[model samples]
Target: MKLLSVNLGTARPVPFTDHPDGVTGIDKRPADGPVRVAAPGPKGTGGSGLAGDTVCDLRHHGGADQAVYAFAREDLDAWERELGRPLANGCFGENLTTDGLDVSGALIGERWRVGSEVVLEVTSGRIPCRTFQGHLGEPGWVKRFTRKGVTGAYLRVIAPGAVQAGDPIEIVHRPGHGVTAATQFRAVTTERELLPGLLAAGDALHPEALAAARKHVARYGG
Candidate 1:
């Protein structure tokens, strides 16, 4: 699909902010069409255009779980409206922002290619936490996310490579299992009964989540 924004944190290790604390590069502008390259910005440390891994923390501070937020192409507008500003200077807090891809509905275990370098596998849904509330300055941000089921997806790197903002995204696989991001979120938060169905999803199941699902299935036996 189309590339929206490419974000990276700087290595300064300053206190976290509404934007990425250590933004090294940005790609919110597209060239030669809708596709844009999110290469290293002039402010970057090495100018290599590659953000070192681990800058993106999924489960650690962002939420209750390990991974948080795989953004979709459409949500960009909504986020802008909510934030009351344009997304630049690492404000969205997402490593890669894409357009024309329905990441909200992406199935767990699906893999997407970023250019020729990196692979992003859908692992889980972002469960809103207090941090999100603080960022949005809304008391009900988490509740809103739960009710809307618009929580972004969580992706793990299958491969690492340099990525820029305008890079085209290609879908490498459409998971055989039918489990979607909404289903996985329900399993984690509300419908404990759906846990078994998620495990039976087989290879389409994320490995990190598989262990818990199997353990639950052993007890639930649906």
Candidate 2:
């Protein structure tokens, strides 16, 4: 129901892997803290900008597109145990780490205005890819995710501004259909064949996503 923390990342390769760069979160940062949210150098797409698009990996991998993974604030503890390291401010490999919000259940078309600066539109759910498996170092990670059904969402920047950790994330709006991020994630990843039902339930999807959903529906909806 509220913004816990806004996160961004530098595209650093895993210390010992051939995989691509990843993003993470910083915890316990104050609302007024200077949270970095975008790339400060040339983007992987050969451009330079301060937009989230500049730092996000969705543009490069075409997998977890536009999604800033939101985990339960408590998951940080679990991850610390799994990874054998202490979770730190800006260290969870997510763009945003939040509390008091069930991100897995956030509906499409939901929007949040952060501290009068950034506006986020929930577009779709985060679909796990091999990169995630690599990050977790678990071979069946993606399958476990599919079965667990706790995936988060992809959000677009409607209004860009400075954000920091511990900022109170407030919901601007919630759609009526109740097609939450978890349902959308499953529909897109597990039942990718049933995309129109999902898209139809979304209230404010971006043009590209809308078009893709329409095309998929046309192709699979028979």
Candidate 3:
């Protein structure tokens, strides 16, 4: 697999976002060349792992566990066909637009060696938010997206390096757990019954999600 584009976003005013500032960086555009990738500190303090891109609302977005987001161009195309509109790379505000990867199907804790040096581990699936629905101008978009179960992928930086369009991606590792990004999304979203299984991903799971899973098991009994 390979990256179709590397996208960056600039903060801009939007009436649709729930952010206190009423601004968002969801309208990302493809970058011209290599963009540096690194862990962007902690959950609330860190922003985008990309140098130029910034995450406006840290309460719901941005963190080491979600330092970078990737979406499959194939999935975008599918959405384009369904929506009867043109969907460009980075339209989903993903940092990396991958051409051939099944991002949602990737197992949590799966490690990918991007380009040559950058390594990213899959941590979770992105949840559709009001900002995303408003940006897309799609009513009931959140439910539709959740129903589709193709919520892209959030990754944690494992090895810092630079990435750009056309860079090759290598699947360097896959944990023993079969819990996929989609499964994790479903567990926390529509299907609470699946929450107990997410423990198989162990520490590799996103901290927030891991905590939720533990809470679910404790309350409901695995």
49: Cα error in model 1, Å? 13
Show where candidate 3 strays beyond 4 Å.
Answer: none
- Candidate 2 matches the true fold with a TM-score of 0.70
lDDT of 1 at 152: 67
TM-score (all chains, Cα) for each model: 0.70, 0.70, 0.99
Query: TM-score ranking from best to worst?
Result: 3, 2, 1
Q: Which one is best on lDDT? A: 3
Q: After superposition, how far is residue 26 of candidate 2 from its true place, in Å?
A: 13
- lDDT by residue (1-222, candidate 3, tens digit) is 999999999999999999999999999999998999999999999999998997999998998999999999999999999999999899899999997799999999999999999999999999999999999999999999999999899999999999999999999999988999999999999998999999999999999889999999999899
True-structure RMSD for candidate 3:
0.6
List, residue by residue over 1-222, the lDDT tens digit for candidate 2: 445665544454554333344442212122345543332322234321223422434343322235344565665566577657676533434566677777778878887765567677776766666656665666787787687777666666666676666567888888887677777766666776656767766447634556767888777672
Q: Clash number for model 3?
A: 0
Worst window of 10 by summed lDDT in candidate 3? 91-100
